[model samples]
Target: MAVAPLFGTVTLPSAHAQPEPPGEVVLSFPTVGVSPRLELGNNVASEVNLPLPAGMSAVRLRGVIRDQANLGAGFLEVTDDNGTFLGMVEIPPRSARPAPLPFDIDISGARPKGSSLPLQFLVRTNDIPADCGPAQQLVVTDLAAVYSGDEPSPVTIATFFPPVLQRVTVVAPTDADPSEQQAVLTLVSTLTRLYNPQPVQVRVISSPRGTAPPPTGPMARAVVVERGSAGLAVEEAGNPGAFLRVSGRGDELTAQISLLDNELQSLAQVTRARVDQSASHQLPTGDTLTFSQLNLEGRAGVLRRSTFNIGVDRAALGGGRIAGVGVNLLADYTPVAGGDAAALTVRAHDTVVYTAPLNASGRVDATFDVPSQALTQRVALDFEITYTPGQECGPLIAPMEFAVDPRSTLQLVRGGPPLGGFGALPSEFSPRFYVAMDGSGQEQLGHAAAVVAAVSRATSTPMTPQVVDVKAAAEADSGALIVANSVAVEQTSLNPPIGGNRSAIDVGLPQNLRADIADGLGSIQVFADPPRDRTVVLVTTTDAWTLVDPLFGYLDGLAGGWNDLRGDVLAAGAAGTPVDLTVRAGGSDPFEPPNVVEHRAPWLGIGIGIGLAVVAVCTATVGLLLWRRRRTDAAERP
Candidate 1:
């Protein structure tokens, strides 16, 4: 099957066939993290980051336009950040019947800045009427880029990762050794994090030892992980594409894989490289970090209404749990003149937390505490400035200017109860974590890789993993991803939210209940290991290991991966959709027994009432039978 690109599907010639001529490839704006719809008013411009794959040239920008204000004569203009004109689409005046208008503008001469083409869009009117309502807004939707060219083949390690990727296939031996398995899982996490927000799919498949796997599609890449002399190289596959080989044994393998680290990968300018010695990358240290430290920069805008988010990731806390959070906000804005209304509102996790007038001193300096309920693995502090000019329509009206300082500080207090369920993860397992497999085999490794990849993609930081036995991981203080069968999970010290034998299972706490579910059932559960003060994620199934496939499918189907997962348990039968089960106020402690009284009260009452009704029915039947027998005897006597 052809790999799906950001916008549409493009099929390339097979590896064994002759190369096909270059064709048009469409990339939609929304797929690359940009809004496809643009709402522009007079004199306002919006910027979009357009990704142009290597060797591909931009052809045109196509979309539909909705002229809400009925501006009779206006044209939409496109320009680069450097003020270079790209092209324009003329907007026709409203006709007898109004409808969405189609537009396609040629931008063949556009050049990319790095891997992305930065372009600005604006709608200019030929004439502005004195009675123009609401400033004449134009809406452009379904914006996409049409590029012409085939993707370039990589000759160096640095260039192997293209600007756009759909899938990555990691090939390992059917009997891969522990080191090789570790390498595969590590690479999965690395690549997933590297191409986040792109919805890239990473699959692990096994082949015979020392045999190269089948070639991948044009938009996909294949990587071979095997144990051998330490090296990382890109070798020719006798086709347009090449496969990457990461070969090493034990620590040597880890050292070689480190070459793929985001900070170090760029140094590998050649097709092949060897790492003799390498140090692990260190995460940021400290309880307080500035916006700059968290990779957030100052944002300035000239719109009447502007908004931006300040994200605080738990991974930035160096793997520490958060007990409390505080933010010191620093901002500057144009003071509102008399009769003008302007205010700045701050929201944490979408709940309004703070508000202040923006008409004083042209600056804002304030500190506020974040509510505990708003805390998660990642917290978004949304800052929005709304300014209404005093004049409805006046030439003297000045646009609002708002800026957020990068020097703003976020203070996190460590040592809180491990967050409940999936919210605790990636953060709880950050910096370094353990993967404990019931059996260190290819199947187990594949499952572990999938779990790690999904979790890694949710965070901006890299999570290091060490493969060990179940006992070692369970005894360790750090969080662990445990992949095992039902019988194996039963033997561990960790308690899962859902547990039972092959024929019966007990769902504890909030979902307090027990049932005889003979069918195979798969489950992915998270619970707090209180004694160790760590989190444990358990992946297992009741009888057949094959049943667990759907759980992974359910996770993969989620657009947000781990972030989309909720509750303490995700359980499903062999042929059913996964269901999320929450433990509620009981905390996510698996050891906590089911709330028998609370969950079973209704059932218990029903059982008692049923018994009484059965007794009454039996009594009534006996009485009626006795009466009928007496009447029969009387009739016979007569």
Candidate 2:
């Protein structure tokens, strides 16, 4: 059985094939999502990027090949980020077709040479793209590794603690008719924010009566509102820490809001966390919120820094990378000669995409196009300002000051359509954030909450997921996350087109490619279908609820970002199975890949270099020649 990392749980591998040894760190996935239509012989290799487990040592790689077409005389080389040669595996001969070829032997020795963080694999062929047949494909179903190392807990305490923090469900009574959505959002928002702060999201559920609670055993959290017949009771998970609670008896939204407000105050009093009650300062979704809304100290004064999230719709761009988007900043500042430095910078994922010096005095208007590549579903804009004179300018009494108008704003130009579905995912708050769950199974709700928390962490937004049933899932107006067991999954009217005969509860796959999702494991997939123009992320497991619970950790929407999670479909293999996760990129259409492009910034830098290089060389040559002529004339005349 593959050992469970600190973050997720796993099942034992088939006795016949083992992905992880008895005790070893592992980052195993069912499929690396390498397209089968590999254009062989391009003399160029198609790269399959694989993610590495954290704090792993003495790594060894193993893979199972399901499909290989015309892969004649080609070799696969696995290299670390530094291109260090870890090892290589040769392809089989064409004349002799092999079924499920095995490359189980360790790639290198006990430890790879300079093992890097992320392992990048390059498959080089001695063939040409033009000569390669259309059916020439290479599909690797299972890629796993055994390593010697242990990582600290991957879970960070937020609303609850891990494994419970891993899954928390907010139970709101439906009889409350139009339940206090605002109050619900408030409670959800407060619970989702864990000060220790790891990008974790909490799933908020409003359930009808009679819903069975998740069976005991696995960790789970439930926050109930005591309204009408409802009552408040809390179960502490282990000895994690203390938490505040709110209780009241009323069904109206207003009453609920009051209750939630009280709850926030109680929680803040105990946790030392502040609740921004005057939400009048909270940033709005989309591009509407302005700089004035930022919670700056007494308008503008000493240095201050803050971060906020803005929701975006990538599907609007037809699921492709966007371009020509701009952010306008209106600032009013006064800069002292050299006394201190004041400026405004906008960063995306910690990289400064735009920065302007607070030069001169008065108002300054600047607009810069944020490269589409720099943006994600949950846009994080960091604002930093400093107006104090240099310590060196000390006591010299230089009237150096700076303050930005609340009118300082950000505008995302909608050049064409909306934008595009994110290549990166687990996106933050959108117009609508919904969690669709099939609560029939015991652990379904817990697994669903984990999924929602992952999204919240990824976007660093306090997501309040509107929990709905399977039927409502089909009709959600915006993006949703669906979590259910395999049987429950099949029950959902809207589901993967994997259906079998009326007598059977099996789903079919194209090209005879298959895996048993019902064999006691979980799988997750995201697609741009249903709700038209919105996305639906689905997570399902066979009967074993335990099997799917650990995946939320593997998704690591917090650390990995949506970088590794591309394509429309991803399947996590059953425990001890061949593949840990399988991804089918761009859905069925291999030509039009997912709407993500990595070729932007680096290429732009090269273009800029070339342009500057040409100008520099030309100008330098002319100047040198003119100087030489002048010197020659002077010497000849003398």
Candidate 3:
């Protein structure tokens, strides 16, 4: 007998069968690093890069505006950086209960320079009120662009990637060999780095040996990886779109993937291309670097209070730990009025390092050393200026202007504790690192790819990985990413933060306390190998390998991936959220159960004493209540 399907499908009426209109895609300003709420003064302006996707047309710019200044007669103007007017809206006076005024301005006439639309927002007040406060401002917020169009299909290698992409799927054979797997991992890292801050989802899927990959959504692209004669080609796929096919054997496969990293990839404006060989250009490294060398721009502002950060990354020192840091700051500011006062303060990692008065010279040249305790993987040098206006606010008064020159110098002295944990990653593994996988084959390779890709996203520099055996990676003096099960990890000389067999595992907790967990657990731990003087990141599971999936899921969910991870280890069970375990120094004993039990003995005795006292008090109260009830019953009977 034939069985019906579990669910039934209903047909819609003919009226409802009409084709639906094209849907709108909303792109928020914050996605491109533009703050939704922009505070502007009389002549101040803010600019944002609105990425224009291929085949999509912008409908309008929509946002809310708050006119806090009560400027009854002014307009908020929108213009291109080149002074091309696009649109404008008049500012209205503030209401008694000021509500957010909504604006929907049509920007159909706006044209993009290259692939992005550079739009500037500014308020121009022709006359300033005599009684206005010094903090008068205009706030613009909740900004977003509405686009309506279908994504265009890519016909060449250059056009294959759009300005905005939701996801990219890398498809490989179900039984992919070592080379093909490595190529897949390389592609994941390369694409993730290229689309930094965009949060593009790069994933992998396995298909049959000689079959086509499953279809993808309009906003997503799929690239098929295979083992064959070397070449990178764009093949036509029916229905939705086309898929990129990259194929080669061993090293050739890797070289083909490297094409994505080349600036000349735009020259491959055809359907097919072959890369004989490819090489990556290494960035120049040294002890001292100027702000401009690190791609930092000078900050300039006209306000009572202004602050900016000068970020120095450890990776900029070529995978070395920071021993000392020195900065020669060059700044310029408007001279304080006769009655007004101003001061400049500098901080490293939020700790005040230097403070000085703003002199009449209108220039500051100060050199200072960063504190040792303030050092981290990424050091932030904050420069702040506070200006107090002495006179009543008026149009005739000059606004405070301050700036930090791009020529400011920073000197880094390398040599300190080889930082352990996630903070040391990406930087410590820079230039090149080794990858060692156990006998698990494709599954292990997939995990390695996830870890590699997550680490690559944390830095601007590209990291090269050489696949080697476990023994080679263990003995090498360079950083390594090791993916293995409990058995494999125990064999390596490298020590992980957490260790033991499947039946029982030693968990490193704070305050010299260690717990023995018998349940199946998976963990990702980072530890410094004192012998090799290198950092090692280990991914292992006590029992089931599937438990490791959640650990990676936790990492992927974070906006910063591995960069956001803290502590030394991340452990999880068969189900539930992963726990961030930090192993503190001076612990009673890391892996010794007897020491941990002894340490807890005092607390255990105190807890027993409290419980016994509570029980005795309850018993006495019950006995007295029963005796009183019996005496009252006897008196009533008489």
Name the candidate that leads on TM-score: 1
TM-score of every model versus the real structure:
0.83, 0.44, 0.81
Q: Which of 1 and 3 is the better model by TM-score?
A: 1
Which of the two candidates, 1 or 2, achieves a greater lDDT against the reference? 1
Off by over 4 Å in 2: 1-189, 194-258, 261-264, 267-288, 294-325, 332-363, 378-405, 413-431, 458-463, 486-521, 553-570, 576-638
* lDDT over C-alpha atoms for residue 126 of model 2: 65
* Overall local distance difference test of candidate 1: 0.72
Q: Across residues 535-601, which tens digit of lDDT does each residue of candidate 1 receive?
A: 8888887777776777788898886778787667776664555766564332333223345224322
Compare the candidates by lDDT and give the number of the best one.
1
TM-score of 2: 0.44
lDDT of 3 by residue, 232-265 (tens): 8887833365888999999889789778876567
Rank candidates, TM-score, best first.
Answer: 1, 3, 2
- The alpha-carbon deviation from the true structure for residue 208 of candidate 1, after best TM-score superposition, in angstroms, is 2.2
Model 1 CA deviation exceeding 4 Å by range: 1-22, 30-35, 66-73, 81-86, 90-102, 126-137, 298-304, 336-340, 389-393, 440-442, 510-512, 583-638
